[model samples]
Target chain A: MKVAFPYFGYDTIALKNFLEMLGAEVVLPPLPTERTLSLGTKYSPELICLPFKITLGNFIEALEAGADTLFMAAGARKCRFGYYHFIQETILKQIDNNVDFYPISQYTPFEFIFQKMPKIFSVSPARVMKSINFLLAHSRLIENFRKLVRQARVIDFTLASIHEKHALEIIADAINLMQIRKARKEIKALFNFADDLPENIIKVGLVGEIYLMLEPFANHDIEKELGKMGVLVLNNRSLYRHIKHLLHIDFDRIKLNHRAYKYLKESPGGEALNTVGEARTFIKNGVDGIIHIFPFTCMPENIALEALQKMSDDYSVPILSLSIDEHTSKIGLLTRLEAFIDILKRVKNQKAVSRVPRSSLLTPH
Target chain B: MIKIGIPRALFYFRYGEFWQHFFRNLGYEIVVSPSTNKQILEQGLKYVSSEICLPVKIICGHIEVLKNQVDAIFLPRFVELNHGLYTCPKMIGIVDIAQIQVGNACEILSPKIKDNFMLAHFQTGLKLTGNPIKVIKALNRAIPYLSHHKKLSNSEDHKQRILLLSHFYNLWDDFIGKDIINSFQSCGFDIATKEDLPDKVLKSDKGFAKNIRWVYERELYNAFQYYSDKVAGICNIISFGCGPDSLIGEIMSKQANEYKTPFLQLIIDEHTSKTGINTRIEAFSEIINRNYQSKPYLTK
Candidate 1:
């Protein structure tokens, strides 16, 4: 069967690979664009969230490309996402009854475990075990990719300070081949050629929804852009942390992923806590600024933004809150990011300059 | 020595003075949080999850502002303040959620005030402090006084008929900002809110759309059913970024204007810039006044 998986974030790619490993022909939808937003706007209900419409648009596009089955993630959380499966399916079926829908939510210990297990593990215990193994292997691969990309970001910033000419090309190459393990190693070797920084670069913290922070396509490579501007980027989201969190076995110090535990303690996914806790950490760490990016109408992120806003004020840190809908354009977003970086850099420099003696401002009189 | 904290939002706009007066008469100290501000909004956001409507956010923010300062914050868990009339589910959950989130730092005086069943318990507490006879007499006097107050407020002429077409604040009393209602009354417009409408709107089918049966939308439907023709014009006050209000307000505005009635869409926030709200209201009132003066409808 030709299955279509609608893109949510960088994690979607990993999921696609995992599905493909099961011998299913997986068709991935293209990255969200204006056409996608337009399609969503035209078909979806006016009051539903922006993500719902975008995903619906993606499903339609994927269907047009000859994919028959639709895959959507389902989670039992306080957010309306629990009902998303039913609502989206109803809406999609209303549009076209032929599209087959499946929700990938078997990982949780819920009421569905007993009922759905027979269907999921129907082939054999061995087959199910193999599928599970495939998921674990692909998850590790994705985690490795995340670490490499983060390393590439650090290298890009360092290279920008020394050799601005080759910085963009090097970073772009690293980013394009981020998913490939061999390419990540080669990119690490290229970074050795970069000259040492004159001084420690200003560090800015990135916080918000997992998808917006982790995925390049969602936020338009915001962290990468910040690195290119010679600013160090700190991102606290990855598939490894998420999987570790879902294990419900906190084997580390304090026995929990503090970010996931605090926010998700109330909700199953721990989505909100990651943003709020990260904001608190970033402020304490003396980061220059914090950025909160989430898809528009995301409830958990909105709550997190509110908490982060207060945290920012209490700690005397500035926060840039950006809501990315399907309508977010690449050029416009980058230009805004450039302006934000310019303003933040100027402010940081002025603060540093002010700390110097007034006599330095004068003629050493 | 009970420091009762009343959030200056929702019901504060309508019953604030009454509650303040009643509590003071009963010898309870009051420490109201300052009128809604960014700090309150921030605090609300801190305590509440994002799925809650903006009004709930505003209320939680108010509670957060008074978290440590009060002996107990009064959040009356009202199902039916009057017989047959009811509150939204969000409002019913406020006291429980507030208790859970705020915890030992703040005491939640959860009075099930729907039928005023706690009146005897409240009197018993008062009796512990003084003469039982005096407490009985006080209750005797207060019962009628409270009922008269409710009757007077519920009466059409004294009550400003404001069709409060907004999102549900879990603490309905805190969302409407009784102070704003008082300000409106002080400004000579009787404040009538959605809660004052009949229960028929809750049952009436929109038949137009199956998905339109949401709680807040039903309240809007109730507002339209009760006061679209009776009132001068519907002042559709909504908070910015509220999802349902954007559509409902627009639809109601069109419906109002189509009926040749004046309607105003006032977007409220934590900012106390009453200038914009007042100006919009004034413009709307002026148009209503003009329409009234030009018509034969006022002849009676």
Candidate 2:
């Protein structure tokens, strides 16, 4: 059976390789574009979030590319994400009657690992575990590459673009755990120049809905744009961490939820609590600001916006919230980012001026 | 007597009776905010985030009206109504939203509702009365009313029947759902709601749409499946930006069409005009009558 999954930045390459190791022909959709957005927008429910529309576009493209089996994540608690696969399957069936759909639940590792994976791949349980291990290793390489790229972009945009292409190529080519480790080392060494390029860049934490955080097209390339503006983007919700959280393999996930209790006492059933935790974490780490993003009409993350605003007030850090939909204009987004960065800089400068010694005061003392 | 306020929106329409019964049993005077109106909506708009659905904004408005008049306002955080399926996050987060919006005017008695609603309710009762014995007595008085309170069977024998698909709150709220129901009745049609069906039937295994995880939404979909043959048409009234309604309304429409039933999905927002809703309801009733007249054999 030919398998296809929605593109979530470079992490899709890791998922594609993992599926191929299970002996399935993987069909990757063409990089999402305006046409894909329109295609999804044309048929998707008018009020559904952006990720739903874009992923619907991904499924349609994958179907057109002769992929019969579609894999989508489902069952994120207290969020509409749990129902996306069911609705998308119905809509896709309306488009093509013969296609296969699987809505993998993010919360259930036992079902996904032992029951769903082995049944679909016709592989042993041990083999599925090994594949998961390799996938995790592979995802870490991509995560490390993202860290370097964040720095490289702030230092040298042209070099960062070149490095990004090479990094994705490395992830795509790496088949084994050893190769994955080697790629990680190479990606880190390639961007070592960025490590020493001064600590003057404004540090901003990126946190929000997982899909919007990972997918550039969904979030208007916020991280890339911020990096180009000479900002250090510290995104804690990398794909490696996300996969770990889904598999219940990460210890930090529970602690992150606990940390968010000050702002949000209960889990709103998505990464909303995580977003709150990350904002607190970023503030403690001396970050200049927090930039939160989520698809418009998103349930969980919309809840996070209010908490973030409250946290910003209590912590004395500025926050820039961008709610993206199909109608979110690039120009409007750029204007907001420019204004936010200016505000962060002004705040930073004011603090710097306040710390000056009495002898160094510009005024007649 | 301690004055306990309940917002006459969202849970108020669904469980206002239960809260009123419980608070009154505990000897606290229960004050329900007036039904949603222009001033309440405007007050809610002043305090709440603009992106939140109208129900939540209206709930906030209700709180605004009650904040000064009562000592404590009851706002329960509904995390999960069923074991797996959950209510909308806005409902769970409303307590937090209201606390911020309404400020410290009244004590927002919000108990986190998990599986043990009795313990939660008892604790909520204890907030008003110091004695645990009194809380138990109040809960005992409240539980039976909640359980034994029956829905009067609509069992309309009229030839033309329509399944009114919506939450009880939306269906009864004077501003929105009440008019749509009146329009159907005024047009000489029988309307059956999701509440009329047995809980067992509404919660029965949803054949293909098992992923519909909202508790009330599950009932709405399963009720439609059960009553699609019994009814002549399906009319769903949902507020805009409602996560479940926005998502499931399409599926509801699709199922209605597949079952060869006339379907009308009326979307309402704060800005929705009365004339538009009236026009849609009128047009929908006319089609149902026409279809029933054309095929006399299909009438239940």
Best prediction by TM-score: 2
Q: Which DockQ-derived CAPRI band holds candidate 1? A: incorrect
* Model 2 local distance difference test score: 0.84
DockQ of each candidate's interface versus the true one?
A: 0.07, 0.61
**Candidate whose lDDT is highest:** 2
Tens digits of per-residue lDDT for model 2, A1-365: 88998989768888998899888999998899998899999989877888899999999999999899999998845788888887899899999999999989888888887899999889988888898899899888888888889989988998899878977887788999888878878888788878876666699999999889999888888889998899889998878898898787889978888888887778877788899998888899899999998888777887888888878888899998888999999999999999999999999999888888867775684
CAPRI-style docking class of model 2 based on DockQ: medium
Name the weakest run of 10 consecutive residues (lDDT summed) in model 2 chain A.
A192-201
Off by over 4 Å in 2: A362-365, B147-159, B297-300
Worst 10 residues of 2 chain B by lDDT: B147-156
Q: Count of backbone clashes for each model?
A: 20, 0
Candidate 2: clashing pairs of residues: none
Per-residue lDDT tens digits of candidate 2, residues B79-149? Answer: 77667668778887777777766667888898988866778888877766778998888777777666432
